[model samples]
Target: MTSGCFFHEPIRLPIDLNEQSDTLKGTDLIRVSKFYKDSKDGRFMSFLHDDARTLYDVFRKGAKESNNGPCLGWREGPNKPYQWLNYNEALLRAKNFGSGLISVGLAAGPHTLVGLYSQNCPEWILTEQACYTYSLVVVPLYDTLGPDACAFIINQAEINVVVCEDEKKCNLLLDKAPRCLRKLIVIKDTRPTTNQRAKNRGVEILRFEDVERLGAQRNHVELPPKVTDLCTICYTSGTTGNPKGVMLTHQNVVAAISAVILQLSEYKPTYKDTMISFLPLAHMLERCCENAMYLVGGSVGFYSGDIKKLSDDMKALKPTVMPAVPRLLNRMYDKVQTELQRSCMKRILFNMALRAKEGEIKKSIVRNNSTWDKLVFRKIQESLGGRLRLMLIGSAPLAGNVLTFARCALGCLVVEGYGQTECSAPVTLTIQGDYIPEHVGPPVACCCVKLVDVPEMEYYAINNQGEVCVRGTNVFVGYYKDLEKTAEVIDEQGWHHTGDVGMWLPNGSLKIIDRKKHTFKLSQGEYIVPEKIENIYIRSQYVAQVFVHGESLKSCVVGIVVPDVDVVKCWASENGIPGTLSVLCNNPEVKRLILDDMLAWGKDAGLKSFEQVKDIYLHPDPFSIQNGLLTPTLKAKRPQLRAYFKPQIEDLYQQLD
Candidate 1:
């Protein structure tokens, strides 16, 4: 199951059962393998009828196979315990809540409140699956989301029941009680202080123990779900507009998981695999993977709450697999470089390692690593949970240098993935052996990719880089209640146009350059792909967040840069530089240092003159949801950000002369 080659099955599902015109469903699909014909090839090789039902069955089978897999929730101190839950256990817990048309609310961390007229846990194989299956739509709310946005999603979801992590989280919903919400159920290791008024307002709040109590009351409980049941309603983080409530059937999760498992089977043969789940569970990436763990009975551990504590959590969990966002890997690369720069010996060792890595160093100059692990790289590996096997980065682009460095330094492979919530999760992911930084990788098993030209795009690919489109069972039924937007994305042929601009690499891999909609024109009429340009700047240690855009009448590309905190701190100390972030950005010395380095990097990357950053303005702030500079996924919100920093950009442009 572990190799660079992929198996292709040409089976297509029936269209009659598919309610959506552009989707495949039920009875028409079968499994065919390019690698092997038998299921004993150390992979999950069972085929489904191309229906949601079959998909769910396969998922359960995978879960049953990986019975000892753990669901590690988060690291506690130095001992990160791996918590295992069997498929029967998860199913019973989900099903025991039983047949209720309940709405679910999610309070990400503690300190949130659940209102009355609101809310809702656990145990026993039958009860676990039962509770897990209820028509409880889990609405995930982040700590940073504004109250109004939070209220909108809750009301839109009509969430009658909520699952809060702690008391503080319960309070947020409690304040909003008397509105659309009905009940609150908090999932905590222990109970929290009760709010009398909140409870009386038609909101019945209960602790995890209460859930256990409810499970005890179920006599002669129902059997396992038929797989097509509406298990959860996951909402997308609205970047362009209001969030859409995506109703994912048990089938959707199962199908997506099967595709991923089959795709990774080559590199990972056993169901006893382990994964670190740090991405928001609300996200399809984590949700789908979590269910995938169920199929394989794999272990999944939640890292410490903050990114700052991720390294420590990693070591504690010692996960065999990890899923991350590009930002995380990029930051790790920055950290390592900054740390290396701090010491002469470490820097020399790192450069030597890199040279050896690229096979550019002579045998005489390359130092042996027999003692190197303890001397140089053990801390980095330990920070990543030591047992690290493979790292997967999704939701955004990971710089090539970042990926390459981690592979060489950490002695682990970093897999880059591409997908959207609508596809249930993954569509394409990098596999072992044939990974390239420029390409996001190939289509996942059972998925098909096609490239279609955007009539308006003229500067993209040789054959014209088309908008990347995908079709597979992994595709969601459609956006719930948003047919127009759904249609705009998925066409009559069932191919989902991924808004991403990409072309086939010489090796047939897909290379995503930028968002098709995000590409803009300069005053000289020259087209600029900002994402490509920004990726170059972002890979540099001195730059963090970057945005490149043009101004009126001028074909200039300007940037709002957030310098790497660690790199700047180290660089400033060594250079005897001092000032606030803003002052340091404008300091002649700092600007000269960054500009010189960036110019060289850009030149080496072979960027077009127009695509190159003409000037960069240092921004004291990081682009985040709170600041409105970036979308929830950390992508720059172009229009708003460009206008907001118009003055600073103008100043930078003036200085460029």
Candidate 2:
């Protein structure tokens, strides 16, 4: 490995630090992008292109610039090649669909809301664009939300019509159809069984293609939205209570796209790039990224709806850009690491190659055609489609070791971003060639970021650690029909109080350290941030997912640990213990082994005695969205987790006492 790598030195790349700086403004406590520091009105960019004022305008511009280029694609069947629709074709369908909605009695204005109840697909984008064409606000509905949550959104948003992916979802909506719902549009053919129930409920059922044909017969003119017109009501997946609908205006989303364009100016997206869309379109991160791609006239292909086949879809699409959540990336990292562990020689070669690549990364150089890449990382690169050049990770903080492994193994620009739905996805995004892990890069051009003191949590802005606050055109207007909730997050001075605590690094980047809402006090009045402690314990090889929990009545924290099945099984085999993972979870020896490892990891990570978990319950089942223990974005739902493991938690506390 050394002989092959020694012949070629890593290439040096030019870097402009000024372009990536977040300038502190006149001792104002807020930091804005350097590119907009000299502006007279102190406002960042409002739109990426003069021709694109609204989301509909962005699509129209794409059609004008790349009319014959592939716009949306999806596979017709398993292992089949992806079929595509060019910009011109997609535009026609959107126009027809918008007209169809009007013909079906939906008012064409910002007041009308259309619900999209589907997974990521070409039809989902078509329906969204159609809504944009007629100034209709879109409200996305997904299955992970369950029928009850879906019903709540449908009733709360006053949605009259819902577009479902298939008859199964159509039936799901029908089962809990709200009184406000008047019509159902099924993307697939309407089943005979659905017709009777829909009719009995006094709601009209229409097929997707029939609606298009109906619209084609009477092509209505576009009712484009103004800059301040309501574009969407994105309902956040709350871990605790009923979801709140975050109202985002055309100006808000457009400014967000502009921010992405300016931040990635040096490595701008172009018409030649293609992205495989797998992340939930309901989430702001995926939605914003897709809009940015559309603005640049790039192609977007949907995953086959089954996550198990995502790899097959990636290989088929060979996409150049990927927007992902940390959970997916973590799985990829774990798989590769497991594969390399089979042979000592293979692991040695991979380590040598990773070292060489990391050396280049430290020098701010990223390239996929280096000797080490070709010799050792070629297989990994090809696993995600050999053409990948950029990977955007968000929704959660990625582990430092996993982040470094992704950059070195995938041979691409792995940019970590930090944001929430209130800010329209990206508040801070790492610049190209910045391989440093654990810190999300400086603020984007559209918004200003500042840290405010949180006294109870002991986080202070003066010390460069506190609750993160953002202010700009990209901030959402308010929560729908909930003025009191809106006021709770957005202050009078126009700053949106992000409930996450962050620390500013010396280089101007922001690192998310803890969550403000997840803090709990012990009986002795010591505050414990469970998320922070869990992050440390998750580093243990035996732990898959850990949830640290404490009660005000308890003196110390307790945890529920989901043991890593493979790692635990391997350990049991080496130690001459025998059982399935579910059985071994109850074994005294296995429990002791895992607890000791977690304690060692916590001690090594500088966790204090009070902060460390005093007792733990080994859980064989992993937390997941379907089980209601995790959100759709794969974040642990603390309240739900507590409710789910109430018995185990009580046992742990009793044992500790």
Candidate 3:
């Protein structure tokens, strides 16, 4: 099973961790499964998986139990059919890949750093597993990154071996990278055009198959990875400066997965379920999600490189769970709602269904498959392969209205979590049936959370808003090679300053408010959270994307808005307006309509007087990852946005009414 791809294998865990019995120890926290031990310390909660010390151990145990289980699914092309690989076969492949690394004189040690530059795919996982097997630190680079970014990370992390998707990515670094790089491994079978150049430079070129064959023939043995051993140096998506290499150890990842499992005790996701992987593996949250799937013996299907084909992929896989970010979820919501708005009757019935959903929420009910579920909700479900039941949203703050709309209209149980790459991802997650639109639930079993006062920003724990600080086993070691940066975030008390502001709800859930340190003051001496302001304006269907800016001492706000294309097109057809999306965005009347709608949204959000977007400039092109306006996870890069739109913003200030 480990040698090659095969089909018809059912996912099976060595044993159902959920079926293992547990006894509640008279406290709010419980070690609900036999997989872990309950915390006896003074901390509020804890879960120690005594046996699962390292990531390799976790997968090794699962692979032994689910040797022949179908583990991974991917496609050849957008229109191509899907393919499968079993667990035993994947492990063997990874072992061979690891052995191949050793044979090349690239023994895994403290200085060993391997770079993986590719989109999410089965090979990425295989390479990562190989890294784990050899105890080599994996350094992941975003596939969308430019040449400079690629070169910067490779040099900064001192990557000696690099694995890429194709010749294109490999070429970006081959010439510019440091001479320390020894090997270029391509996932594709085709020979790289830069192969000769790499060889001339004394850098070896190995196809993925070559690595596997080397390891299999070499009879590689898996090194026992220690809990404290460095596993990966995950770089943060630098919306501000150069990407920082986050040093995450095997213990950090183990603690994170344990906490995630503790939070999801009720769902008990196991080998029987399936998940769709569309997010980049460079992002720690998505990486963590894939790891959790592998540990639970659940199957994961990789989405094609073209994200526009996700709906088609969904239909083919019929995945049970989907891990997403706010941008993706919001886009899905927008597309579905736009179609529903096509007919007046359809829109009316959708509103009626929303009201019924609100009533069920107010009454604390678990819907026993209602009439609306069959009529409208089921269609949205079918469009997404008809089997998606749970969605895990993270990487950015989700709007309350969007959350409500997803549960009410899309008919999926949506759960939002809050964390960053520094925290190894899920610090807190919403429970399955007990979800609050505003709150992101409590800290996970292994984490201890607190909100510290930030008087400079007028945020205080008493007012229910302060900088969120976390201390736990899941917390990362520190910023790689930057002790000064490490000391700034982690202190003598061992708390990792999250930089994000949050508060505790009456129900003890955590509600993330805004960034504490990055905010600037507006004219009237009001400190404004730019992301919050932008999110509010985006709630209006008229505005697809927005970036809010306020000058020091300026009472009013100016926004750069990207009008929703579908909504604008519909409006143009109905109002006798004639223009493409770009032309309409610059149209005075359309601009007025969008600005008015955004102003109304700000008002509805109960924003301060200074928070109102008094003037707006429309850009036809949306904020995209490619343009550097947005991060890979779709979070706006505020500094970059301001610099790019400086001229428009300056004119807006002068023309302010």
Best by lDDT: 2
Instruction: Compose the digit string of candidate 1's lDDT tens values, residues 569-619.
Output: 678888888877777877878877776777788888998777777777777
User: Residue 299 lDDT in model 1?
Assistant: 57
**Which candidate, 2 or 3, would have the higher lDDT against the true structure?**
2
For model 2, how does the per-residue alpha-carbon lDDT over 1-657 read when each residue is reduced to its tens digit?
A: 111222233323223543455455456456777655542245777887888989999987877767569999999878799999999899899899999999999999999999999899999999999999999999998878888899999999999999888888988998889999999898888768788889999888898999989999999988999999999999997887888899999889989888877766656567878999999898889999899889888999999989998888999999988998888888888787888879999899989998998998887666677888899888878778788877888989998989998888877778888998999888888877677788998888888888999999999999999999998889999999999999999999999999999998877778899988999899999999998899899988899999999989989998999999989999999999999999999999999999999999999999999998888899999999888899765789998999999999998877777
Backbone clashes for every candidate come to 72, 0, 5
Candidate 2 lDDT score at position 139:
96
- Residue pairs with clashing backbones, model 3: 1-89, 2-88, 2-89, 523-553, 523-554
Which stretches in model 2 have alpha-carbon errors above 4 Å?
1-24, 37-41
Candidate 2, residue 467: CA error in Å?
0.8
* Candidate 2 deviation (Cα RMSD): 3.1
Angstrom error at residue 229, model 3: 0.5
For each candidate, what is the lDDT? 0.59, 0.86, 0.76
User: What's the true lDDT of residue 568 in model 1?
Assistant: 81
- What is the TM-score of candidate 1? 0.81
TM-score of 3: 0.90
Model 3: CA > 4 A from native: 1-48, 77-81, 200-202, 357-369, 409-412, 577-586
